[model samples]
Target: MDRMPRWADVILIPLISLILAALLSALVILFIGESPIEAIKLMISGALGSTYGWGYTLYYATNFMFTGLAVSVAFHARMFNIGGEGQALLGGLGVAVVLVYIPWPHWTIALLAATASAAAFGAAWAALPAYLQARRGSHIVITTIMFNFIAAALLNWALVGPMKAPGQEPATVSFPEATNLPTLHDIFGIIGIDWSRAAPANVSLFVAIAACVAVWALIWRTRLGYEIRAFGYSEPAARYAGISPFKIIMVAMLISGGLAGCMAINNVQGEAERLVLNAAEGAGFIGIAVALMGRSHPLGVFLAALLFGFLYQGGAELALWMNIQRELIVVIQALVILFTGALDNMIRMPLEKIFLAARRKSPPPPGPDRKSTSAEAAE
Candidate 1:
């Protein structure tokens, strides 16, 4: 039997973890001689107050959504794919190559091409790690980490040498106007809604939402998802049932890599309109925390990504208005991640015990016993 209701396990534990992290973060802010309440107010106003703020928040969330989904897919196969940063980087390269080399007549066509290219590059980058882990027993975590560094080096070399724009900067040329995607503001304008300011938030936010729906459907409503989850739960049992571990690992990691790579569509094609160095910007690592906090579900991943997005935008505001250091913002983020990920058991175990004890003590539901009822009637 479950120690607690699924609802409590899914929502309450993570909520408490977030509250605890917030308390610790509040103390840190107080220690720095700042008002935590005021800081929070500033953060809220900066990140959620205006449509412009929301635009940036949504933009950041879009990046997290893709990477979080990547992690979630890998988790379903009992694999820890930590190379999202590298995969996303390669995906960006793919987008740049597609946009620059091919002349598409419309944004829709460009978007489709860029997305496929990005997914391919990201999947290809992940294939080797998946192969190594499945065939040679190389740890997925270690291989993915190493691959991140290799990807960075390779991107650097390409950017500066062959793919470099004809300039001192190590970035490709800006994409053509035809390939530029419409921003949220443009979309809203068609419906007679006014977005107050311009933000990098673009059509990719819709794509991210669509991705979430697709992942949920794939994970919960398909035979492949069942096999993947079965493998994740027990490799021995999966093997006994004739499931191929190698195929599961490869497929899961490839899907993960593809999802991670799709983030390039948001940051590169949608926003930057060019491939830039360090574009992934630690979002890959952040995706780990997101996956943990979200419990590797698509819905959870979406919510967690939004929360982190708020943190990123809000932290910027706090730093600008409250004189908080950039490192402190990082510390706050670290606390959230630490509590939600590393210390999850600290919260979960106690909740489980409490729920189990309560369940034990609760009166059992009355049985439909005809004998007992007849006896009572006789008395």
Candidate 2:
């Protein structure tokens, strides 16, 4: 079979992307009259040099992981989802509403309810565009982006007009104690480790990794995942093979939007959480680049999320150290997107040739005709 080697295509693309992103971002740093080496050193020191920094990095990674996974899931079905921010916002709102309204006194039940509520809202949010695309043949990119804006505006109105906390200066209301996600301190006592001191980057990081594992297993081992991949590679081919493109697209969006919903549980579920005006604070848009850089693979998305998380945390440190605008991080991130997007072909050609040559060298299995004739003659 002259099939292209998938692994060869997958591994090299993102590796080349990171290398190019780094080199290009370094150039941008220098062009801005900053020492890229010093900037990067300070960033690494700030992001991973201490326990406190590691905690923040872990927290940042959590957000990236969820958004990245959301974007990647849709991409697997060849659907480009730009609605992560909106979906996540709705998810957060769902949890907030449930936390405020649901009067569960038990801590565990409240937490579970909040998380599940958020996911459900995300599914609903994404369903609109999915329905339009699936049933009415709307362009997903346009519809999803419009919905993202709509979600942001609605969130602002809700926060300021209806859900506003009494006598509070911020736009958000207070969540009940039961709704708060328990910290590591609530569950375990690590010797010499103060879990209470960690940032709001919640325990959702572990959950994200678990989700990644499940996604990997789902895509590689299940029939549904096979259909998704088939659609991604060739929608017409998938339909010709008896797979329903509309159903697959809907499933992909639901799962993708659901992942963003999980981010709401992780980010804005507990105490001091509320809808603080419009916009997803840019997490939704960042997810597009993250998914592209990850090649829409679970493992790739995890690593890409980690790298994006590092840039975010370390870039903040770099800003503080150099007394510069924090927007410098945004510049670096944009460069990453540029390079990562170029990776589709940049890293594929050579590896594809190498793998193809190797495959050609291996002799093919006996054909059915040859096997039948051999057995007949032997008998």
Say which candidate scores most in TM-score: 1
| Candidate 1: stretches off by over 4 Å | 364-379
Which ten residues in a row are the worst by lDDT in model 2? Answer: 370-379
The residue-level lDDT of candidate 2 at 52 comes to 61
Residue-by-residue lDDT tens digits, candidate 2, 1-379: 3334334345565677677778877887888788888988998998888766766777777777888889888877878898999998898788778877778887678767876888898888999999999999999899989989889888878877888777755366667665567654544444555654565556567778988888777776789987887887788999999999889989989988988877776677632455566425677777877777777777777887888888888978887888556787677667667766644555556667876677679864555122212111110
- CA lDDT, every model vs. true structure: 0.87, 0.75
Off by over 4 Å in 2: 1-8, 168-170, 184-188, 191-198, 270-272, 347-379
Clashing pairs in 2: none
Number of residue pairs clashing in candidate 2, backbone atoms closer than 3 angstroms, sequence gap of 3 or more or interchain: 0
Q: Whole-model lDDT for model 1 versus the true structure?
A: 0.87
